[model samples]
Target: MMRLFIGGAVLVALAGCGETRDGNKPTGEATAKAAPAGWNAMDACATVGTPAVAAAMGKAVTGTALDPVSQPDGLRAGFSMCTFTLADGAKLTVLTREAADGDAYDAAVAAARKIGEEFGSPAVDVAGIGKAAMWTARPAALQVFLDDRRYATISLFGADFMPDGSEAARSAATAIARKLAS
Candidate 1:
C-alpha cells in the first residue's frame, strides 16, 4: 500500500535524527521535550519525553515504538505517535502533532471522529487541556486541540486509563500538551 511506503520513507528520513529521549520531566511537571525546531515523525517520541507516562500509568516505561502518521494521500503532515511499552507490558501511546495549517487540523479531527464512530463512540467533552478537547470512549483516546492548527491525542492500551475523570492523569496530560505547544 502507498501508506506503508510513505511511512517507511518517513522513518528513513527520521532515522537521521540522532536525538534520543534522555531528558527528565521536571518533578511535578508533565511536560514533553520540545523538539527544537518543530514536530515530526522523528521527534514525535519527544511528546512522551517525560516521566508523566510512567507516573500516570503507574508503571515504568521500558521501550517505545512509533506509528507513522500522515494526512490524506500519504503526506507526512506532522502526525506521529510514541507508543511506550510499560514495565507491566502495557502500552501508552501519544499521538500529538501541530499541523501546518488550520484546514489540515480540522480535517484530521473529523477523520478521528469518523473512525471512533465504528465502536459506537460517544464523545465526552474535556476541559482545561486545550483550546477545546473531547474524549471518545470506543477509541479510548483524548483529543486535545491546541488551537485551530494543532492537536494531540493520548491513548493507553492494556491499562484502563482515562484522563478526564482522573485528576493525576489530566494534570499530567495538560502539562505535556502545554510543553508540546510551547
Candidate 2:
C-alpha cells in the first residue's frame, strides 16, 4: 500500500511540471509564416504581359517588358522574392520560384489571393503572378505585385487608374514578398 501511494504521488508531481517538447514555457504554436521549400521568387511585373487587352474605357494597356530595380534588403541568397505597392498604399508580396516552370510561383500567387479574399476588404486588391504559361488569379487594382525567380514586380495605380510608380516601394515589397513566397 505504501509503495502504491508513493508511485501515485510521484506521477502527480511530474504532471504538475507541465513539460513540453522544447521544455520552454510551452508556447501554443509558432506564429511565423514560412513558405514551402524549393521555390524561387520573382518580380510581379517582370512577366511578359499578354499581347493586347481592352481597358476599362475600351482602351488598351500594352504589354511592357519588366523594368528591374535594385533592392539590397530584398535580396536573400538562394531565394527569390518580390513586392507591389497599390496607389492606395496596400502592400502585396510575392516570393520564390519565378521560373517559367515551377510550382512555387503558382503557389505564391494562389496563396496571396487566398489571403486577400479572406481579408474581405473590398479596398484590398489581390492578384496572381506569372504570364500565359503560369498565371494565377488575384484581386484587381490597388497595387499589383509579383515576385518570381528573376526579380520582384511592383505596380501602383490610383482608384482612377493613374499609375504611381515607386522604386523604393518596389524594393521593400520584393524583400517582404521573397520571405512570403512559398
Candidate 3:
C-alpha cells in the first residue's frame, strides 16, 4: 500500500511536467506573482541545501541538477525544479510553480486529490507548512500551496522510502518553502 502511494505520487508529479494541450510554455507574468521579495526564481535549487534538508536525510546531500524541466504548456514560465542525490541513491526533488490565483491553487489541489482517489489513496491535509498543503500517502509526496500565486512540491524516491508524513521530508520541505518565500 505504501509503495503504491509513493508510485502514484511520483507519476502525478511527473505528469505535471509535460507540455499542455496547446503546446505552449507559460509566460513569466502568469507565474511571476507570490515570490518573496528577494526570492530569485532561478536560484531555487540553492535553497534546497538548508540544514533542515540535511537533517532530514541524516547525511550530506549533493545537488545534481538545477534546471527547469518541461512544464504544462499553460505554465511554461511558471515552473522550476531542482534535484539532489543522496548517498544511498535516493533522490529528493523540489518543484515550484507560479499559479494565477486562488482558483488555480484550488484546481491544483483538486487535481492532486483526484490522483489519489484514482489510486485508492487518500490525500491528507497538512498544517503549518504553507497556506495549505496536501500530503498524498501512496506517493509519499507533499504539495504545498504557499499562496494563491505560488506553490511547491517535495518528493522522495528510492527504495525504503519515507511516507509523506515523515518528519525529515516535511521539515526539508518547510525549509525550502521558507527560502522560496523569503
Candidate 4:
C-alpha cells in the first residue's frame, strides 16, 4: 500500500513538471499565445503562428505543425524550425537559431545569402526588415540578416497563391523576420 502511494505521488510530480510555459505546453500549435523562451523551436513556431501567417500572406492557413524540429544548425546548436501549411497547397517554413557567437551568426547569414542566390540573382533586396534581407523568386525564399546576434528566414514551395506582385510576400516575410530578430 505504501509503495502504491509513493508511485502515485511520483507520477503526479512528474506530470506537473511537463514541458510548459505559464501553465501551457510550449508547442507550435496555433492556439498557443506564447512559447517557453528556453525552448527555441517552440518559441519560434508560436511567435509566427496561424493568425500572423494568415494576415501576413493574405491567405488562409490550413494547418500548423504542433511538433517542431530542434537541432544544431551546423554552425551552432539550438536551432528550431516550424512550418505552416497554407490553403493553396503551398507550405511556409520558419526557423530560429541561437548562435554560439558573432562569427557563427556571420557564417549562417553568408550561407543563407549564397543559397538564396544559387539559382540566379532573380532576387531583390528588401529594406526595413532587418540589418539586410533579400527575396529570391525562383525558389520563393526570403533571408533576413536580422542583426549581428540573430537571423531568420521564410521559404515556400508552390507559392502561386501570392499576389501578382512580390510585395505581399516581401512584407509578410519582413513581419515574420522582425519577430525572429532575437
Worst lDDT 10-window in candidate 2: 48-57
TM-score against native, each model: 0.61, 0.24, 0.66, 0.64
- State the lDDT of candidate 2 residue by residue for 1-182, as single tens digits: 32223223222322212123344433222213333443323332332212111111223333333223223232221222233343344433332232222223344344434432433422233334322112122222222223333323222233332233233433433333333332
Question: Which residue pairs show backbone clashes in model 1?
Answer: none
lDDT of 3 at 115: 61
Which of candidates 2 and 4 is the stronger one according to TM-score? 4
lDDT of each: 0.53, 0.29, 0.57, 0.54
Residue-level lDDT of model 1, residues 4-54, one tens digit each, is 432343234322122223343211222243433555533467655747676
Candidate 3, 141-178: lDDT as tens digits:
67777766566777777664543346555555556555
Comparing 3 with 4 on lDDT, the higher-scoring candidate is 3
Which candidate number maximizes TM-score? Answer: 3
In angstroms, what RMSD does candidate 3 have relative to the true structure? 5.5
- In order of TM-score, best first, we have 3, 4, 1, 2
lDDT of 2: 0.29
Q: Write the per-residue lDDT of candidate 4 for residues 19-108, one digit (tens) a residue.
A: 233334332222222323433533566767678788777789998764344444333334445678888877777755443333334444
Residue pairs whose backbone atoms clash in candidate 3: 5-138, 5-139, 6-138, 6-139, 20-73, 26-76, 26-77
Off-target runs (Cα >4 Å) in candidate 2 are 1-97, 121-139, 142-156, 161-182
The TM-score obtained by model 2 is: 0.24
